[model samples]
Target: MQQIKIKQYGNAQEAFAFEEQEKPVPIDSQLLIQVEGFGLNYADVMARNGLYKDAPKIPFVPGYEVVGKVIQCGKGTPPDFIGERVVAFTRFGGYAEQAVGDFRAARIIGDRISGGEACALATQYCTAYYMTDYISNLHEGETALIHACAGGVGTALSQLCRRKGVTVIGLCGSEEKVAFLEAMGVDFIINYKKNNYKKLIENRLGKRKIDYIFNTVAGNSFKEDMKLLNYGGKIYCFGGAARSGKKDHILNDLAFLLKTGFVSPLFMMMKSHGVIGVNMLRIADNHTAVIGKCLGELHQLWLQGEIKPVVGATFQASQIGEAHQLLESGKSMGKIYVYW
Candidate 1:
């Protein structure tokens, strides 16, 4: 088996090294997938830079999702799963030619779906589904704000909100993304780089307060979102893209934390505002079944044409460095996939 390993923590080009390794065998309820390709998440970039706390130590493979055929199944797994084409959620090890994942986290895909689309269903769409359907209740006539609204999860969230008849206020960093979201039928698009998103959203909404906010850029944005939230509104914090590009030092980490500021439980209670933090890795660790349910539901939605996965770009496994660089650049509009 061949895999890309993180040799060191720094820029993408200097951090990765290709190497040959023995193929891993699945154990317990796990399945070994002959990986066709894998998807890139922002966490992979954070892992490469040594910013993700839960990432494995140096020399480890960094990937969250894989689309491939099931070649082998472990104990308690069904033999019928063998030879099935599926998308699976890998804890790490997904950067290799083969990877193992809990059978419960794997879902079969039809020939109609491309590998890049299947990869989106694993981590990105599942995360969006878990937040929108599992954790929060979205209703018709409500308004929601989505950060990074042109990326993988953001695209998924936007479509999901649309299905529920909720108006979407999408925030992006570039005009290209604004056009992309506009084509996707986003109710409103704000280029945060060119204008104050807070004022723009306020001007657009007038007296209507946001009912929900899907925030990936944590920092001063959290405080800003709180101000725009309605009494019953809730904000979901999932990523810290704002922390990227900081100096590799403890002081820099602390400074980023300070910028996010602190929240008081008493204040939130009195104001009737709620803050929810989502770390899918932790959820997968303690409640694997929840992830399985989310994946299954998302798969059904895709099959029904209720949601579409956006493939921003594709790269060969040898171009892993390029993939990381593009994802880190935040210029890619949708999911980026690296194929073996």
Candidate 2:
């Protein structure tokens, strides 16, 4: 088997090494997946640069979602799973041509959904569904602010909001992303690069405030998002993309804390605002059943055409480093897929 591993902590191109490894065998409740493809996530970029705390130690494979067929199954697994086309959430090791997945975290994907869409299930769409559908219960007529609104999970949120009749204000850093969100039927698009998104959104709605905020860009963006929230509004903070992906961002880290000051429980209670953080890896570790339910729901939506995954780019497994580069560049509009 061939796999790409994070060789050293640095830039994407310099961090990966492709090598041969013995094929893995499934154990109790696990399946051996013959990897057809996988999705490139921003966390993979952070992992390559040694920034993501959840990433495994160096010289480890870094991948979350994988799409493929089950070639073998373990003792506790059902015989029906073998040869089934499925999307599996391997917390890591999806970068390999073959990987192992606990059967509980693997779901049978319908023929209606493409491999790219299957990849979206484990991380991007599942996260969006878990937050909005299962947790937030985003209702009709609500307004949402989605930062990085053209990225993988951002696109999923846009699709989910549009289907639910929730007005979405999509925020991006590039004009290209703005155009993509516009086509996705976002109520508003703001290029945060040239415009003050917080001020622009304020100007448009006047006194009206956002009901939901899906934020990954933390720091100043986090502070600003709190003020934008309306009464009963909730902000789901999943990541900190605002820190420019530099090697030594210690100074930037300090600046991030300075800009985003500490807030006591009293302030949140007084304002009637809420902030929830999500680290999907943590969820997968502690709440496997929850992830299963989320993936099942997303699969049904994809089948019904209520939601879809956008494949911004696809790279062969050998080009793993380039795939990481594209995802981190912020140029890729949707999920990036890498196939064996």
Candidate 3:
């Protein structure tokens, strides 16, 4: 079997290496999967760079979600699962021609859903569903401000919001991305680099404020984002990419604290405002069943044409480094798929 593995902790392109390995066999509780497609996630980037605290040790296969068919079943496994097409959230080892996991961990995708959509539901889309539905308590008709509106989670959120009739103000870094969001059915599009997004929303909404803010770009963006929140609005913080890769990242946090003063969470308490930090990986660890339920729900929506996966690009398993490069370049929109 051929697999992609992280050679060590460093640059992703340098760290990822393709190699041959012995085919894996399943135990009584596990199922052997013939790899079809796997979703590339930010976690995989972190795993390659050694930034993820929970990342597996070096010289390990690195993929988080996979969509494929069950080629072999373990002892005592159900006869029905044989040759069934499914998607599974494997903590590791999905970037290969074959992978293995427990049968119960896999979700069988119906014929209505394509392999690409099933792979998406296993990761990025699942994260967005859990973040909005459970962590943020987003409701229909509520206005949402989503950062990175053309990215994987952003696109998924837009689709989910469109289904629920939630008014979404999508924020992006470029004009091309703004156009992309407009095509995705977003209510408003702001290119943060060219215009002041905070001012644009303020001017249009007229102090209405965003009812919910789903943010993946924290750092300098957080301060401005918080200002756009209505008195009772909730901000779901997911990532600090905007503040990362800097020598004084901690200092930036201190500056934000000083600027906001005691009125951060204190204001949330006094005026019903809320800031909920969300890490989907953590949620998946403690609430696997909850996450699984969200995945199932999103999968059903995809089947019904209420939602869709935007696969911006697909690369072969041998081109794992190229996939990582595209992710780092920050140019691609939607989910990137790696197929064997």
TM-score of each: 0.98, 0.96, 0.89
Please, what's the RMSD in Å of model 1? 1.0
- The 0-to-1 C-alpha lDDT of every candidate, in the order given, reads 0.91, 0.86, 0.78
Query: lDDT score of model 2?
Result: 0.86
Candidate 1 lands at a TM-score of 0.98
Better candidate by lDDT, 1 or 3: 1
Candidate 3 worst ten-residue window by lDDT: 240-249
Tens digit per residue, CA lDDT, model 1, 1-340: 9999999999999999999999999999999999999999999999999889899899899889899999999999988889999898899999999999998888888678999999998998989988889988899999999999999999999999999999999999998998899999999899999999889888877643999999999988987888899887899999999898875689988888898889999998987888999999998888887888898898899889999999999999999989989989989988999997
Candidate 2 deviates by what RMSD? Answer: 1.4
lDDT of 3 by residue, 32-64 (tens): 888887888876776676656577788888877
Clashes of each: 0, 0, 0
By descending TM-score, how would the candidates be arranged? 1, 2, 3
Best of the two (1, 3) by TM-score: 1
Off by over 4 Å in 1: none
The TM-score of candidate 2 is: 0.96
C-alpha root-mean-square deviation, each candidate: 1.0, 1.4, 3.0
